[model samples]
Target: MFTRKLGKTKIEVSEIGFGAWAIGGDAWGPVDDGQSLRAMEAAVELGVNFIDTADVYGDGRSEQLVAKLIEGRRNELVVSTKGGLMGHHRDPNGEPVYGRPAKVIEAFENSLKRLGTDYIDVYFCHLWWDKQEETEAFIEAFKQLKRDGKVRAVGVSTENFDYIKHFNREGGLDAVQLDYSVLNRSVESEVLPYLEQHGIGAVVRGPLRMGILTGKFHEGTTFGEGDIRRNWPKETWFADSLAKVETLKGLVNEERTLSQAALRFVLNHPAISVAIPGAKTAEQAAQNVSASARPLLSDEDLSIIARVK
Candidate 1:
């Protein structure tokens, strides 16, 4: 419900954005297009102006769905999408490929067509390239898009905080999306501080830790066959995450649900511009936006959550 400025781009976005990965119906599991559309519409109705999707998500299916939902109200929304990761219609598990200048141009064109938009508010390099040279080339290409009015801002999504620090130092990006949650505080050490100092907006993904922070599962919970969680390392990673979630239950009470507290925890940070949590149904969308209305976590609440694992 609250809005924040996205770096120096002059674009204002909702604090709780719609994460469109699950709506794409690829890595997460099977998805219903009807349900996804309703979820997106519900988000818009609830005042969500930001939507983040990737070109690789369901091979552009997510962008198409977002396009369908925001058909007549393009100017009212700040739609951000990523490119550079390549996937084919036949091969769903293909590896990501770094976008050279030519690839970057082609990817932007494809995403524009899929999203049915003349310009993207923010276009991120889906993942960091192995070489700085490659990343520079992509940023140059993104600048070209900006010059042509095809893209308004450029960003990068990555876990490597060092790359982010360098990019910020060089003034190469307008925003940075990274995985950050109560369970994942690695970004607090350096990445967050640097972004805040440089006036670079930070879009936090996995604010709910892929649903673990929602308190929806227990130790023995089983994921569906096609679910991406099935491939997660259950012996240590999954079990440990579930254990952390149990510890987080104390933060949830009559005031809010575990999911709501989890979202607010990420939003409490001064450096964070928005948190994108994925939803597949209208009820889920409503539940997520409700968190934006709640007060942020207190110092004691943050202390308690920080003690987990």
Candidate 2:
């Protein structure tokens, strides 16, 4: 697998990292724990060194599973987890009541326990906080974690550049996770440029656009119970995204699958440090990591994809 330097952190990570969301077995659909463990094992054997999870994902089930994956080889991988969704720190609208330093620290401590690790490689604030005070509280809280040798890097998982600026007002941000894919180019306009300019790592979350860019779903496709995509109304972007995938399918050939092409497209941008595509099984995990082994998209193919609308 091709390795890239995660911006600012200087940690070399595989260009294709494993996103552990689906293995959490809640939002995506039913999953088998044995299969999940094997998927991660397959990824690691393929040289995947980075794994990103969240406290909210299956309410820490993902982190616990990750703990099992990293056993006896914690130093061989880079683990990232997010907080900011726990405790009684939310308003009536369910928006997080940010600026609570104590609660933030508590959340991090709990995550450490769940992962069965003394320190985390990367820690991200799962949600965006608009207020300056709230951002300052997080900065301070994260600073404490770093000082205590708990977290190596701190980031915020948000697309809002404004919120990023507030959090980085003191210049303490290391990375940011945002959704980016062939079907969604929203981050290219400003967010990506800012990260590149400031040397912040950009870890893409949804490089396959929730499997739509994988060309596995068709107009007649339907998701089963507990699948998050089941609620997507086909009358809207769901239908539109499927049409765009047809155009993208032309890039698929004996050299690569549609999913590999989509991942390559995301990695084409210089600002991206790594792309985390979630996999539920060993086959899926191997396929994701194998994208890095294929040749990059040719200029002609990129030109054709650029005009895809």
Q: Please, what are the lDDT tens digits per residue for candidate 1 over residues 84-132? A: 6542211234422342576678878889999999899999987554466
Stretches of candidate 1 above 4 Å error? 87-99
lDDT scores in order: 0.85, 0.88
Task: Kindly give the stretch of ten consecutive residues in candidate 1 with the minimal lDDT sum.
Answer: 87-96
**TM-score, every prediction:** 0.93, 0.95
| RMSD value for candidate 1 | 3.1
- State model 1's lDDT: 0.85
